[model samples]
Target: MPALDLKGCLDDSPKFRKRIAVYEDSIQHFEFSLKTLTKLTRLQVDSSTEYSQRQQELATDFTSFAQSQDDPIIAHALEKFGKSMIEVEKCRTMFVSRMGQAAYNPDVKPVIQNSHVTETFISPLEKFVKETLFPIKELKKRFEKASDEVDSVLSRYMGKKPKDPTILETAKELADARKGFYQVYMEYVSKLNDIEAKKKVDYMENVLAYMYTKSAFHHQSYEILKDLEPYMRDLTGLLNDTRQRHDEETSESSEYQDLCAQSAVDIYNPLNAVSSSTVSSPGITVPYHNTTENPNKSGYLFERKGGRVMQSWIRKYFSIEGEYLVCSMRNTKTSKDDDQSASYNLRVCSIKLSDSYDRRFCFELISPQRIIVLQAENEKDMHEWVNSLRMVNQKALNSDKAPPPLPSLHRRGVSDVTPVIKLNGFSGSSGTVSDSDKELLKMVREKPGNDKCADCQAREPEWASTNLGVIVCIDCSGIHRSLGVHVSKVRSVVLDKWETESIEVMLELGNTIGNSIFEEHVPSDMETFRINPNSSPIERDLWITEKYVKRSFVAHKDDKAQETVNQTFWDAITEGNLAEGLRYLARGANVDYRNPNEHLQTPLHRSVQLGNEVSVEFLLQWSSNVNEIDENGWTNLHYAANSNNVRLVLGLLKRHAKADIKDESGKTSLDLAVEHQNVQAVTALRLFAFDKQHNSSPANSLDFGFREAMSSFKQNYSFERSHGTSHSALDLRQTKSHSPKESSSLHETGSKLLRSDSSQ
Candidate 1:
């Protein structure tokens, strides 16, 4: 028996043709009702005087149409058709209810009064129902009813008749009717569904269009409001309130409309057929399984299996780009304990449809339980499958036109530009000296004070106070000293003086001391002391004729004045020029001469303290004692140690300078060197001391030897006292025992040695 083409019967047959006629008639009524309702709404909104009377007439017409239907099938169809009209009424009631609420609102009154704005807002809904939604709805009902009738008639005939004779006979007789009915129904529904889907697409497009139009309208309203500012006192308030309400309502309504339109389109759109333009097409098909049977009792053969049927059909009709099959299975077993029945699986395959493999095909299992499969031969076929499923045309999936790329959101801002500061003048607050302070500090370091202990006074050195207020020489300065209470470094110690007065008094005292202590002397020939001819005449003449001439005159007249002048010149040379300064010492100038203003360094000590190696060599060569001590009890070796110069220290030691000489703080040159980590200086000092000890003998002269040995013993004792012993004092005592008389003598000698070491 041949298969029946139900689509043809629905389209062409005359038998049961009245049913088709009734369906068409009912659709017309549905369209009329929609149009009537739309017209009534417009009339009412337009403020027509007879709108109430017209609405009454429309309700009567709708009731008459519902009552006129007589045939049960036709009546049932009409009832469903009427229900659609009732839905329109329900929509109308909702609109009226919203409008009534809007009318009563104090906010919306002014918006309603604006004729332009109100009309613009109502136009889209009016156009939508009239042009798209109503027509689609009417057609959908008509075809859906017709399709149902055809299916019902065919199903009854197929189920009751025998397949061998009655079935074939009946099917042939019914073939034309069935085909005609189905053809009309499918064509109509397909077209209706297309229209409905297009309406959804149109809705989104219209929304975008409406948004642009509304934005422009808002701009125009702003301009109008600007021009009407003088008359806007109450209207502006109402406008603001109405705008708020309108925005909220429009947002909600637009959302609802979008969802409804999209749903209708998604649920009804028909799958499109594959196009023949492509050589190879992409397609997929899935077979339905028998859900009603138990897996063990079904007797389903492998060759006759749904999967095999689907695979065969796909291989025969579908062509894809790939060779391998991709299949997904959805197991419907309810639990772990449930029987392992036939699994409902969807298999997709890609078959090469062209020699170039440019085109492919696909297939899908649309209804697993019904054994229905959907096939696609190319891109168009894929679209058809998507359409059959009533899915939205996901813009993301479309190949014809690519989606616009999303805009970039990440970027950086310009950098900050500010200025930096440069520090100068002051050294860091760590108390390190600036270059100027270092110059002054060097001068102070060269000279020590004269107001020392009797023994220190004998040394006749000048001392300056440290920044910490302790009086120290170059050597004593290396040792940490206790800060004394008296401010002796200040020139004057006046008890009852103001700060300014004290400063002036100090300056006067300093000048008095400087003038008294540093007197001028004259040379034998005035020409030798004459100002240079090339020098600035005024400045040179002033110094030569006034200061130098007066001092010269005083020197020539008095012997005391002459000696004072000689001392002053010697002091000036000692402070400034070490070479010229040495001439004074060679010419009977005191080696230990001290200036009044602090730092009373002898020529020898000053040279070493100033880090003047040439001057120091000159002084040492001139037979200046290498062991000479300053006012702070610092010897020349102490100055070398404090200077941190290993060459100068070795030079001094080579000249037989005592390494163990202590300053007022009781630090020897070796101790000071070690404290400062001057390793070479410390080694040289130690070697010199060792050499001195090695040259001395123990037996030749008992008394002289005993005295020398006693001196050595005292020197070592004083060294240990000044610098806490490298070996403990207890160890020193235990190692050597002497008679009480010798011990007493050693103690006396040790005290004297300590004093002598401090002085030199």
Candidate 2:
């Protein structure tokens, strides 16, 4: 490169400070803008679909702009600008999410306060100011001082002849100083030219063209705060009377509408529209990805032991989908084509380090009410699972449209739920439904609104889904039912029998209520066609599957309730599920809980009547009172004595149950056993009564009960598996069942029972 003429005419004075001050002002403005954005971000106006879409659009735009930069300095400037903008967006998003949490949960502290703006947004730009712009400003002052020294020397030597010795010496000094100052000016101009073109002379003119676009985006984003922030109550996290913006999510975005139209269960996959791409159950899809970027694993997870089921490792496929980490279970028995792939909508899934005390290489995959702990084969696989899931969790959090939180189905067919029109007639009292039911029915009868069929939006819909609680037209009901009862349990409003509490569930979860829970984050705002009541089955099937099964339009709630209701407390007694009862006991429920609607009887009384010998044993293990009476004055002994189950009767008796307790009819356990002609039960009780009669000494109740227990144990005793199963075997019948002290008590009781029998 040829050295350009070193002559510089630019003046050196306090005037250069004025030029530098402008850049300082710009830096301050940028920092202030970032601070403002950080403060605004905490508002969490996630309901605005346009803003969310715009955010993604901005990211793509930034990428393209960065790519287009050719000059090194300008590229670096754009790069920093893009990064700073991204940081601002990130800070804003986090703030909104925190604000959203605070809105729903009073307990969660407000998002990280003003530091959100200061830390992520303002700090970065301020650093840029200090490192880049401030240095340039300081150098400009030095350049001015150098220029003044050269200028004064040159003026003193000007108009003097070369023969003058003073003039010649001053001229030599000015030239050397002028050369150094020229270099400083060029370097200063180079840095300033990167962020702004101040003039074409600053650098190659085209180098800063991209700055205009960057500036425009920042201005647009900055102004957007004014439009949306007022509607958000918690930018500062002050108060309430707030409601979720489900309507905004549904009514405004066409792109989401397109995604909804495309994502049917049969023809589409929320993971992608490939058929049976991965092994998955309803809402837990681990999608199959072809790219090397995503990690795919066929692994195992221990599903939490639920009602009457023990913990078992389930085989599953795990995949890293864009912004979503999905894990799906596989079933070998399923031959259906769709079942071959991951059919679950794992949109709402999340991850955490395992709290598992016993297992190693484990982490938890969480969905709405469901949590699964997965164990990797080794540390490498565990890290992979953790890293991929965390990335997707973060990715999904950044997205404006997150997948719906689950209990979502993956079956694609015409198993449409009937519209929940008429509340079931069995709504508690007088063989009638309540006014709430009537009001809901009246609303259902009104012209179709947000409450209409989720698939076709058909008015006068007739069926409902028990899980999602959304009503569909009768035509769509067939489609939902086709997905099978596991996917969506379709029920009728006027035909099927309904539990009073179930009716209450429907009442509390009508269309609007259902929308709030399932459609909290709406994917699209486009209106969809409602299937005519007479539409073809195929059409209804496709629509229903797309709407409910794939959950194309469903968005995960920012603030869904995570509290487990332990509803199984009542279900255990009704179903005689021992595991279910035990789970509640472990969760600290009352073993003596009486179901007021079920004759005010505790679970023990119910278990005995139902002949659930195992359930009764499990309930008793929790220290339930065996002699507790129910509404009819029938104790557990009374119920067991009249039943055909000899095991249940024996189990109760071995627990030292009171045989003399009377029912309302003055019938004792022996009386009921004999009266009912229950052969085995009668024999057991007769032996107990005979033993009692023969041993009529002045023994305390404990001794008398112990003797009866010995007789019952001897009668029912069998040689089953005698080692691991010993303690599991009922009470005294357990082979090698007791310690020395316990054995001595049993031996003494057995001897007494033998003496009583012989005496008799």
Candidate 3:
């Protein structure tokens, strides 16, 4: 690469510089014109469809013009200009889409015939001022600042010459300076880029704040305005009064100067002296007491005496003639006696009052274990008396009694003794027992004679106990019986697992019957052996491992039995059968039974997905927990909606099934109906949403209910009639198809109805 001289390139020609300047000027004018035109067009356009089309055209034109420019600086400017145009267009589109044109456009001519064209003409100017031209002003200021900086640099380098330098000389000097200035200018450009990025963030924040503030103002404007009315009235009155005072101040008269002076002496003199003396003066002396120990503790008693002393001192100092001499007290203490067993401790303190130039006193006496203050007219006098009584008592009380320590574990001994066993047994010769024992013994010794029917209380004399201890009569008992059916049913209804288990166990124990001899002397192996018929197919195929039991029963070995079960299952599902299927399932038939090579769907799934309403309803009634999702990740409602089966959707929704369930494509039943333009299905989904909103807790009023209904109708109408399809059965032909008289008649009728509805 060649190392080109930037200085030489700059110094080449003044014409080049002039060309650049002219290009910038033209670009600025072009931007302003384009902005103005855009605003005018936006104001005029009534429909979003037209606005979007116009915006696309504007973007294409600006982009084309930018691409046509060859100069790098001009091209860069054009690119920025195109971006600004695109941004404004985008903002316009967003505004129209969110708020609609009716909000942005205002009627300009009420006197003339009502028309949108008048409002449209003024829109371009509004847009230019609001969006485009306002931003341009800031851009112009920045450019001006940059131009000033460039001029300053040029002047500094050129110096104060006698005359203006020649264009060539000036260009050469600027060109030389431009090399270094460009580097610095580039830094400023980088800073501007940072500022612009921050401004974008700040602009977005401001827009959000403005939107929130506008919403809040809309909600509270009435209340705020109402509150401000009274304050505004009061402010007006005050302003008027101030103005009157200002006018009259230049025309006032003075009088009663002597009377004012006398009133000042009578009232202000005493008040002034009181106010001045309220705060303590720096040099004012207050009576204080010093005692042997803690004299201030009894200072409250010296308050009156201190006041008298202060009055006396004040009178003496000021030479005022007053009968009462209220002076604040000094110290008042007496010496200790030689016969005293303890020392006296006095306490004293003072409080300065702001309302008067006097200090209140406090005094107390302290001993080794107790404190006492003497009551007097003032604290200063109390302090003197309290100090004299300080030696009365000063000693601590003593008592001697210690608590014992806690005992250790090793010190506590344990005793071992066997408890006597009292066996309550039935009377057998010498072994005599009580009546309760006899009853218990009989219950334990007697055989479970009969298997009691839970429903009728009928006893079956000939009965046998299964391995599970369920007592059954020979007639009712079957080889295929298992505990799984009962367990499953119990688990389904009962919420607590442990509680269900306990109930099942108790029921089994109560129903079981056994011979008395076997009950009392049964081996552990007998209890461990279980004849489980409801075992899984794989488990049923295994041979019995117990050596004691030589043979095991296998129901599948009988081909008739297997065929009967399969036929029963098929018949149950075919007849839209719920009871038969549940019976078969409970009887240990294969639940995953298939017809042939086709993908196997369970009886529950088939009845739910494709069966008649009665069949589905029957299946649901039989098994409340048959929740099956199909191969397409669709529930029953999805299949029903896709098939436009309104009744099925209603049934499923009635059963609390979700309508907005998304399929494998992430499309819900509503979305699918919308995609297919199924009016009935869409209406059903919307009605469901409306009902949900209406039936919500804390029911809404009639207006809200009507509004919700209307909204639902509108939404469904839009969805159905979106692609220019007639929403209703009414297919009224256009007026153009008839004569002018017919067209006029139709227009008049339509206008009347519109007016009537608008009035309502």
Evaluated against the true structure, the overall lDDT of model 3 is 0.38
Q: Please provide, for model 1 over 1-760, each residue's C-alpha lDDT reduced to its tens digit, 9 standing for 90 to 100.
A: 1222345443556643454455446545645654675566556556531332244345445545645644332232333333333323322322222233343222443122322222333455457556765665566576667667667767767787444557766676567656665666666645544544544565466445545434543432343223223223322343465689999999988876665554423222223332223213212111111122112111111111245434432121211111111221234443443322222222221112222222244333333244333344334434443332222222223345443333222232211111111111111111122344445433332334323311112131223221112222211211111112121221111111112212222222222232222223434554344333222222343433332123332223333453574576456545654433432432345545554454555666777777665555545534567786667888888888765555567567656677777999999887666565443344445544544576452112112233334334433433443454322223434544333454445434433433343355
What is the Cα-based lDDT of residue 726 in candidate 1? 28
TM-score of 3: 0.21
Write one digit per residue (lDDT tens) for candidate 3, span 29-50: 6456556665554554446435
- Sort every candidate by lDDT, greatest first: 2, 1, 3
After TM-score superposition, what is the CA distance of residue 432 in candidate 3 from its true location, in Å? 68
Residue 105 lDDT (model 1)? 27
TM-scores of the candidates are 0.20, 0.21, 0.21
lDDT by candidate, in order shown:
0.40, 0.50, 0.38
lDDT, candidate 1, equals 0.40
Please report how far candidate 1 places residue 599 from its true position, in Å: 3.6
lDDT of 2: 0.50
Count of clashing pairs, candidate 1: 53
Error of 1 at 563 (Å): 6.0
